[model samples]
Target: MRRKLAAGNWKMNGSLSAMAEVQALCEAHPEPKVDMLLCPPATLIWPMASMRGEHPLAVGAQDCHPEDKGAHTGDIAAPMLREAGATAVIVGHSERRADHGESSETVRAKAEAAHRAGLLAVVCVGETLEEREAGRALEVVGEQLAASLPPGSTGETVVVAYEPVWAIGTGKVAGTEEIGEMHGFLREALRKSHPEAADAIRLLYGGSVKGSNAAEIFAVPDVDGALVGGASLTAEQFSPIVTALEGA
Candidate 1:
């Protein structure tokens, strides 16, 4: 079975003092049934990772460079992230696409880089609000999954996160049936490319996920877990999301 995870994307937020949240999250619940990971800003990963080693909590990086090391200014490569104590890294977030103009090929290269560095890669793919309204959400997401995934892809090296471009950080969520359809399509797509990946790769939903609505969204047929947002910054808010998943 795919391990259920409540991965948090701090997303351009947090500072030295903000590490308190990470500590609290770790302290509040040490033996969670589902997995818990936090993807904080690059600057804080190492310090936060030192908080504890035995809990289910793991520190992750928000982004990573495709190249191991280079003259690329303002880029943190996978090896650098690994050195910083991150067990995983998020790549291809919509913000990266909009702000840095990252493409499918670049994300694929980054995913490969993560694999090479032994860091779990959580690859994000989704359609923008316009595409959803235009009836091309699935098509856009499919193209992304096809073109961006690394060659020889398997469940072990990757995790897929589906976050609608519009819904992310907008307090909006894909409806239950819509989520089921998208995740189901993703499962079939993965199987078509790598039949052995069945029931291995965890599929996570992101974008405005919170305790109030987590269970409803997670209960969908193919919804394995979530990549939490604002709610995950705190233990009180994030725990309920995990707790809900258990009951679901």
Candidate 2:
């Protein structure tokens, strides 16, 4: 069976003082049954990973450069993230796609880079409100999955997160049915290209995920866990969500 994961993305938020929550979170779930990950901004990866101590909490980075080494001014290479203590990195987040105009091909290259540097790539895909309302949600996400996943992707190297563009950070969430449909679609899509590892690959739902609705969301078939946003900022908020998944 695939192990469930609770991955937090700190986005552009958090500073040195925010490390307090990391301590509280690790202390709260010293021996959590499910996998726990926190992808803070690049600035905190080293500090957060160091502070994790012997806790099961894994630290990750928000993004990385597609190349191992380059003259790219503001870009970080995957190897650097690995050296900085991050074992995983997120790519193709909707925010990046919108704000930076990243394409699926770029995401795939980044995923390949993550693999080359021995980091798990948490690839994200989602449909905008217009696409969803037009009933093209599945089609859009499916295309993204096909193009964004790296050539050698497997369960060990990749995790897929489906976050509806309309819902992210908007205090909205896809209904359980909607989440279930997209996750199921993503799994089948993964099988097409990764037949051998499809079942092992975990599919996570993201979008305003919190304690109040985590249990119900976890109940959905094919939903291995979540890629939490704002709610993951604190132990008091995230702990309950983690507890809900452990019970699921």
Candidate 3:
């Protein structure tokens, strides 16, 4: 069976003071039943990882450069993230895709770099509101999934996150039926190429996930967990979501 995961994307938020939340999270779930991960900003990765030493909580980075080193000003490389004590890194998040104009090919290369640095790649794929309205949500996500993941991806090296663009940070969330359908479709798509790793791969749903709706969302089929946004900033808000995933 695939292990359930509860991951938080702090996005561009948080500072050294925010590390207290990580402490609270670790204290609340000293021995959590589900895997827990937090992807903080580049500045907070090392501090958070250090504070989490020997704890069940794992730390990750929001993004990374494809190259291992050299000449990429203002860019952090995958290896650099690993060196900062990050065990995983998020790639192709909607903000990155929209704001930086990151294409699927670029995401794929970054994932490859994450793999080379021995870090798990949390590859994000989703559809915009227009695509959904046009009945092309599946088509858009399918294309992103196909092109954003690197070749030879396995369950251990990769995790897929589906975050509908319209829902992220807008206090909106895809309904259970919508989430389930897309997750199931992603499973089938992964099975086509990585048949051996498909079943083992955990699929996470993102976009405005919170403690209140977490249980219902987790109940959806093939939804192994979530990629939480704003709600993840504090233990009080995020712990309940983790509890929901544990019960799921």
Q: Candidate 1 lDDT, tens digit per residue, 43-134?
A: 98988888766776889998898999989998889999999999999999999988999998999999999999999999999999999999
State, as a TM-score between 0 and 1, how close model 3 is to the true structure.
Answer: 0.99
List TM-scores for all candidates, in order. 0.97, 0.99, 0.99
lDDT of each: 0.88, 0.94, 0.95
The collision pairs in model 2 are none
RMSD of each: 1.1, 0.6, 0.7
Off by over 4 Å in 1: none
List, residue by residue over 154-205, the lDDT tens digit for candidate 2: 8899999999999999989899889988888888888889999999999999
Alpha carbon deviation, residue 121, candidate 2 (Å): 0.1
Candidate 3 lDDT, 35-122, residue by residue in tens: 9999999999889989887897989999999899999899999999999999999999999999999999999999999999999999
**Model 1: which ten-residue window has the lowest total lDDT?**
19-28
lDDT of 1: 0.88
